[model samples]
Target: MAKYEAKMKETESSVIEFIETVENPKKREDAYKLLEIFSEATGYEAKMWGPSIIGFGSYHYKYASGHEGDAPLVGFSPRKAKISLYFATGDTEREVILERFGKHTSAKACVYINKVADIDVEVLKELINRSIKFLQETYGS
Candidate 1:
């Protein structure tokens, strides 16, 4: 296994346990579905990131600020308040997509949506695929 995969498997128990305690079946289901979508979209297997995120692919990165680390290429965690989506890269079309995303808030590189039901799934899928493509083109092994 890849090093990260081993780490993920080693931590799988904690990850699954936290998902069980999240107390929202629908949110949990949405997270699982998002994993499925990302997997198909990226052709990369999903790995548990810590005890919450379901991460797809992997990459090594260094910031201009001197912070550097290896992490999942893209990921998402279904938090109690919202679904947090992480993209290591930025998309210029983000604003256009956000206008169509229904209800969401975004920081520098993450997008938070209250729930899957609150947005258009088709648009979500499009944005997700676009983000994955952007990453692959910009930073691929």
Candidate 2:
């Protein structure tokens, strides 16, 4: 495996093992399904960003402001309280989704949801795809 994939594997294996041991079978299944959906939708191999996030794809980015790094194209971490989906746009320009999404919260660049059923997965994919295109056009990723 490549270095990044190897590192992610080492991290994500622990996460999958932890999830398997959890008390809630439903949550574990849901998380696994989410991983599958995201993996298929993004067409990126599954890799762990950390203990909880199963990330798909990888890209290198550098801003004109002299900031640059590599990051996953799509990622999510299933936590005890919620699942956090990682994307570039959070609240600044996603007013449409803000009104459409069932019940979700956000930070500067991530979306927090109680469950996948709570939001429109198709719409979410559109947003992610659009964001990726935008990033590529803007940053040449």
Candidate 3:
């Protein structure tokens, strides 16, 4: 089999510039606020992942099938419709926190909220720390 390549690799793009390009005023503001929250929670500087995501910290993982790649430990993107939160999946603590996270929808890999105010910031911080811990335990940083 050919080697697999991850599409969402980190880039040198300016995160502030990317946030400035967000067309939605509310989403743009939320992006800045999330930047602050994620930084304070993870204690890692924000980085631009691919073109759209504002990420903090990173880790490498290899699946059972040998698919391996580096990804941000925690991140968020202020998309057109909703802010997509990226966190480690399959974490039970994350699932538990989501119950009290307020109005939001979740997918297999991401949590979607209309805005930062829609969710409990404390829960969000817990989720961020939990994700970082889970990833560091599962895959060394």
Worst 10 residues of 3 by lDDT: 1-10
Per-candidate count of clashing residue pairs (backbone under 3 Å): 0, 0, 0
CA lDDT of every candidate: 0.72, 0.69, 0.93
Residue lDDT tens for model 3, 1-141: 766778899999999999999999888999999999999999999999999988999998889987888899999999998999999987888888899999999998899999988999999999999999999998876
Off by over 4 Å in 3: none
Per-candidate RMSD vs. true structure? 5.1, 5.1, 0.9
lDDT of 2 by residue, 1-141 (tens): 433233333243654675575456666777787777777787777776656667777777666785556677777777787878877653345656556767898787678988777888777776677656656666576
TM-score-based ranking: 3, 1, 2
